[model samples]
Target: MCRRSSGYYAPTLAALALSATLGLAALSAPVAARWARTTSVAIGAGLLVLTAIPWWHGVTTKTPLREMPVHGNWALPGEYEKIGRKLGAAVEKAPVRSAGEVGALAYFCECQVVDKFSDRARLVERINDARERSWLYRLNYLMLDTDELERDRLKPDYWLDWRSGPNVGVGGWSTTGVYRGSGHFELRPDRPAHKPHPDDQGQLPSQASK
Candidate 1:
């Protein structure tokens, strides 16, 4: 796994954006204790209200793991753990290697796994993006490691295609399969999964040609 400063600072920046109202709410009087208490209580109350639905439903109705989405393209996250088992089985039973982007999907793929952040085929692209940006943004964006070693590029058996239109099955990669939004979109490979015609058994594990 590679560490990027963006991981830390992006959320910090978001938190700052969220508290922008504080800039507007600043008072002329000096009351540090009172001010802090009022803001804390407000934040707490807002949080409680946000959780009111799920908390109440869980306590009273006992909702299922697959939570119904409140709006578009939004659902419970981390279903990839369960779906990974299915993908692992599928690739083994099928004739293809693997490809994916989502960390959770990659994590549970049960393949000849490499560190996705370091060993990913796409690392060069991200590193290029980081390098292309101005130096000042480096501390808050994808960090660059000037001396980082580049891995050999290898294409996998399947190409994962993640859509963001609807939250359902991809049906298939193209023609027959309709592209829905993402739930397990990575599992929906762009091309049919297959190994080279003269399939070699001595190669890496089937699931991760990542």
Candidate 2:
């Protein structure tokens, strides 16, 4: 049996603790005004210190889902990369197929990333807005394609033959897929090929093809 520590709840709990402390302080203002200056200061200071304990614990134990590298070409904006890493991990664990599942996982991953910004209500609203716009669906598709391409799971020509037929696959396809435009045309052999030297073109040698 795995016992989950309350440490994971530190951030949210700390915020709530701070809010409650503030409310209490506000409510006590009238009563505190009647007390000695030293007494009021001490009580306020004590509450402040107590409120800080949870925040301290939260900061000290907070672990990022992914660590950003110090130097690399792949380095992305810190916040965006953090979101990407969390989304990537979720993608790996998912049983992928249709676009809908991908979008749902991506949204959850985005929520985790947004939680770091300390705005739960805003994050939830953002997720709902994105979902309604199908932004998550598009984002998921891009993520899926990018991951596959990086892993070499998807080939450049994967889409080239997709519309052709059921049996048509990227493999065994020609160097360039069949031309869809006007019929293929080759350079006419009759017209002398462009001469490399200017002098050669100016003075047509007898041996040069007429």
Candidate 1 lDDT over residue span 174-199, tens digit each? 11111234433444344534532212
* lDDT, candidate 2, 1-210, per-residue tens: 011234555688667656655755566666664454555466667767876886576566755423221222111233334433444454443322211112222343442211112222323333334445676544644433333333532111111111222223322111111222112111111322432312212211221365
Candidate 1, residue 46: how far the Cα is off, in Å: 7.4
Off by over 4 Å in 2: 1-5, 32-133, 139-151, 154-210
Off by over 4 Å in 1: 1-54, 68-82, 92-101, 112-121, 125-151, 162-210
- Backbone clashes, each candidate: 3, 0
Worst 10 residues of 1 by lDDT: 171-180
Query: Candidate 1 clashing pairs?
Result: 96-194, 166-181, 172-177
Q: Mind sharing the TM-score for model 1?
A: 0.40
